[model samples]
Target: MMKIHEIRELIKLIDQSTINEFEYEENGAIVKMKKGVDAQVVSTFVPAPVAKQEIIAQPTVTSVATIEKIVEEPKAAEEVAKVEDANLHKITSPMVGTFYSSPSPDAANYVSVGDKVNDSSIVCIVEAMKLFNEIEAEVQGEIVEVLVKDGQLVEFGQPLFLVKA
Candidate 1:
């Protein structure tokens, strides 16, 4: 996990960088930051409700965007869960990166819709900062849907596949 000072430094570095968004995760802690057109600082981390609220409430920052919209936005996410079939398992991206269906441009995809997969099967890869991270289908099931296309940018926790277990 990143220390409080480290998080602050990251926020500053992201604010100054050309990139518009960044996400870092250690263990299960995640830090996400975004810069809007006005250059306001927008950041979030999961599992640390206090850290999340405190970051928004920090007095040192000139203008931190309100967390209300960010906080409320995820509430609507539950509705999607309700809409999905109860027996289906969602394969989600663990980090913010680009989704790749195959190992190489001409290689066969790791898995396709209608393909059977076990708990340890490599379903796809997500590339972040030149690192190719192989993504696994943690559920034993048939992939019923592929939610993302190759070379697409995906967000942390965004579902990439739906499987019927």
Candidate 2:
């Protein structure tokens, strides 16, 4: 069973964050909560409708030990090349975005197959929102494998490149 304080803390986090809903399970109890949104489409002719805030909370208990066990399993690491892979550097995404290898639509890619990169070299670009963030090589090495493709949606901490140092 979840304590009341834990539930309150979850509520506060939802209010502070951009997330509209949150749910969690603890000690055999499941809790579902959501914050209501008030979207008002306004016109120039009349007064806008007042927005009201609503908070909903629901709770239940069920066996979830099997589901939890599956989620806890560690993911298998991807094997890149046949060469000695012990000294390879895993270049991961710094933000949640779409990855692009080139600066512009018609421009050549920053790095290509068999390209050597130092710490300051820009290997790719991660586009989050309207901003294009340059992803640099943190270690000096030859690019062994490009794990992601152009315009691929990448999550935070997702591996984009494997470099054999």
Give the per-residue lDDT digits (tens) of candidate 1, residues 1-165: 889999998888888888887888889998988787775665442432334222233344344355555555566775776677676898999999999999999999999989999999999999998999999999999999999999999888888999999
lDDT of each: 0.85, 0.81
Expressed as tens digits, the lDDT of each residue in 117-162 for candidate 2 is: 9999999999997899999999998998898899999877888999
Superposed by TM-score, candidate 2 places the C-alpha of residue 123 at a distance from the truth, in angstroms, of: 0.3
Off by over 4 Å in 2: 1-83
Q: List the residue pairs that clash in candidate 2.
A: none
Least accurate stretch of 10 residues (summed lDDT) in model 1? Answer: 47-56
Backbone collision tally, model 2? 0
TM-score per model over all chains: 0.53, 0.52
Report RMSD for candidate 2: 24.0
Lowest summed lDDT over 10 consecutive residues: which window, candidate 2?
74-83
Listed per model in order, the count of residue pairs whose N, CA or C atoms clash below 3 Å is 0, 0
